[model samples]
Target: MSIASSAFLATIPSPDRGVWEIGPFSLRAYALCIIVGIVVAIWLGERRWQARGGTKGTIIDIAVWAAPMGLIGGRLYHVITDNQLYFGEGRDPVRALYIWEGGLGIWGAIALGAVGAWIACRRRGIPLPAVADAVAPGIVIAQAVGRLGNYFNQELYGGPTDLPWGLEIYRRVSPDNPAVEDPLGGVAINDVPVEVVHPTFLYELLWNLGVALLIIWLDRRLRLGHGRVFALYVAGYTAGRFWIEIMRTDPANEILGQRVNVWVSVLVFLGAVVYFVLARAKGPREEPETLRSPDDPDYPDSGDGGAAGSPSGTAESDTAESGTAASGDGDAGTGDAEAGGPATRPGSASSDVDTGDDGAATENTASTENTASAESAPAAGDPGAGGPPEKPGSST
Candidate 1:
């Protein structure tokens, strides 16, 4: 007898099916969820990137490389860790190629996706740290959305529970081979037509959302930079993943009496913490106005554009032009000081008299003029010059 009538509990219910087939095309909820998450991440990341002074279209371009790389990496990690699905004697090896059915590891996705992002960023000359900081919160929220796919797929839930908001799960039949039951257990038939399980996916979704908010708040308050905000995102996500992994009853590989993911979470979290501390000591937030990617040296650092190799690019030229103009002086301080010394001394008599800090420059100007005039003055009684003007007709 089915257990549907044996129990009554207030709880969240898992979707009946996550796959939809139309005519010749099949649309999967899992894949759709992942796609939506990626789109949202890019949209949010672009906004944040622009706010950080990064050029538009940069995020979209990077995503072109990153998204595919992440999918491949995520699938690779899942297949490698769960090789039984393909590598075992009775298991079909080609089944590993079918990614739409579900399974993607977050760690592998991040690690390999970084490689693609680095390649794209190098081409654009945008600093990876700056991009990472901008994209961190968006990435977390994307993970939150990805968890919804798991709920739809009826996967990754925890042990039986009777909580008010517990997830009511159903028996899941394998999409690949209907003859075999899903290796990952579903709700016990004895428990009910629907049995409540701890909604581990939902817990993770909420956790990721919370972590994203925490990062945004901290980024604003402390002004974290040098990829520290990204590191914090990693640490924060892994911290939650550790506890959540423990609650999950899924048959993950074991290491030292814990799930493989648990160990990964701990190690990654520690590395993130260490990196955050070290990176902060490296520097403050980058001045966004002058941001230049590694490959684009010709990018201007000031208002008046100049080729990096040109003399005009040097600070001196720009200062002479803009700084002098802004100060309303044709000749900047040094040039004017030299030329107008004698002329200026007569106008500001106190300029010569005063010897305090402010007046020191004026005193120096007057002294310089006096020295020049003395050197040019006629020697004592020599012919046409000094002692007395000779009587015009007399040859002294």
Candidate 2:
């Protein structure tokens, strides 16, 4: 197809160039897209994790391990699955290490990235399932963003299409050697068009974003935890991937006349669904206190209630002091009565009795002793001696 005809067809044009040369450095849009996606994933994961009662910087710390491992894992999957592209008789095997050229398998990236996350979780004394649940939405969003790289690279397109949203594929040639057709290290020239194809990358990008929103909504509504959110994400992504994988026209290894990814997606989706259902037995979301390490400053101690400086301990001490003071006052009143003197109650005017004769003083002392004895008597059949009254038949 000619550029003039494609321009009149209302199709999405592919990027004219995916790389830029600046003096001594080269910048590839694919790499930039990947970097931007990683940053977005980390920022979003940190926010979600903190909201879920995780430590503030825990996501960032885990990303330091997961991101690198994910990249390596993605590259390895691509090379191993498409071994013919790198290990063929005429192909350069070194090209397998050129990740900037664009090709990352999401399945491999997730599988190996989880290993890195597990290691980080273990070191920080955090549960891996909680971390996975917190970051599931962010991971899907990152995948959506990374799909833009596939757009710029003019790769992962489907068979020819006449739809309005069809992607225009322009022939690319090496900038230094115009005669050499180099898709990865080349730039489109002469405004020419080769074909217009279905934008499968765009389809997957939109599907991924939709799945992210779905996961977030379900997570909030159902309060999913213990890796259920992550499991749901996996199931949702693979469901879309199963259809999208079959639509792609790219050369790939096949099993039973079907693409290998289609088979992988089916198995993974079943596994995720099973895990999601069985995970219900794990109980509800973890509380904030349980998410913290024992050494954390805000961590709740087991001995908090009776600690010396704690509120409950201070209250107990005050009650004991008050009881001792009351007992001392009771003993003083008894001693004064026994010595044949009127026992003057502290804060009572009636205690100021006339002591002109010994008989009057003896009478006052005897009356005080009788009143004290009556006031000190317990209720009938009370279990506690001189204690507060209780209703009949009530247990202590």
* Ten contiguous residues with the weakest lDDT in model 2: 304-313
Query: What does candidate 1's lDDT look like per residue over 1-396, in tens digits?
Result: 334533544678676667665777977788889999999999999998877766777788899988899899999999998887789788999989888878999999999988899899888866788888988998899999999989878889999988877888766656556655652322222334346789999999999999999999999899888899999999999999999999999778889899989999999999999999899787778766344443344344333333232222454434433333113122222233333232222223433322222335444243655657433433212222233322211211
lDDT of 2: 0.77
Instruction: Write the residue-wise lDDT of candidate 2 on 288-389 in tens digits.
Output: 645655445554432332122221234443323222212322332233333333333334344344232233443223465645743443322223344443
Candidate 2, residue 38: the lDDT equals 89
Model 2 clash pairs? none
Deviation from native of the Cα of residue 301 in model 1, angstroms: 6.3
- Candidate 2 segments exceeding 4 Å error: 1-9, 302-396
